[model samples]
Target: MQDSNLFDDSQLIFRVLVNDRLEYSLWPTVAGLPAGWAESFGPASYEACASWLERHWQHLRPSGLLAKGGGRG
Candidate 1:
């Protein structure tokens, strides 16, 4: 879910809630918008985002983008 027109004063709070597990929230406050507007979650900062991606890589795979045996061909 991406938001369009960031100039419209907004605050964005992206989160990761795992019912069985614990709720993990990721809301890095950014500036320049009014008060109720923001762009998509983020062009998240590098290191943290990279770590998250690495951890969830397998679970976030796109099946349609895979091949017969699941390799990206």
Candidate 2:
């Protein structure tokens, strides 16, 4: 039998990644972290990561953008 790919397996563990702009994303633990992004939470289930992000990342705008006078004229 072929082994399941960790990236493709929702049941596998995941992590919540945050970039310098404070953007959050769900990343599979098997994948290498991209440049300018770091793990903020998890090594937990996908649902858990999603829940954490939902609770923490309430703002959709990047922090830098918000700092620039709410990115408005």
Candidate 3:
């Protein structure tokens, strides 16, 4: 029998905030997001936002839009 893994084994970890009974997922947002994103262009400008994301790219998880696990590829 073969074992199945449902998620990616990437080292990246998603940043999450658990306050009270609510869980918050923190993600970088552009000045003008295409759609379905909360705008966060309050204080930081576009350049700053881009730099921040680049600096922390290693720590961010890829959007779970792909089937990522099984046997060795």
Superior by lDDT: candidate 1 or candidate 3: 1
lDDT of each: 0.39, 0.87, 0.33
Runs with alpha carbons beyond 4 Å of true place in candidate 3: 1-34, 40-42, 59-62, 65-73
TM-score of each predicted structure versus truth: 0.27, 0.80, 0.29
lDDT of 2 at 65: 84
Candidate 1 vs candidate 3: the TM-score winner is 3
Instruction: Please give, for residues 8-64, the per-residue lDDT of candidate 1 as tens digits.
Output: 323442322222222233343453333433333344553454456457545433444
Off by over 4 Å in 2: 1-8, 71-73
Give, for candidate 1, the lowest lDDT window spanning 10 residues.
Answer: 14-23
Question: Against the hidden true structure, what lDDT does model 1 obtain?
Answer: 0.39
Q: Per-residue error at 45 for model 2, in Å? A: 0.2
Highest-lDDT candidate? 2
Give the candidate number with the greatest TM-score: 2
- Report the lDDT tens digits of candidate 2 across residue range 1-73: 9997766678878999999898888999888998999999989998888899888887888899888867643
Clash count of each predicted structure = 6, 0, 0
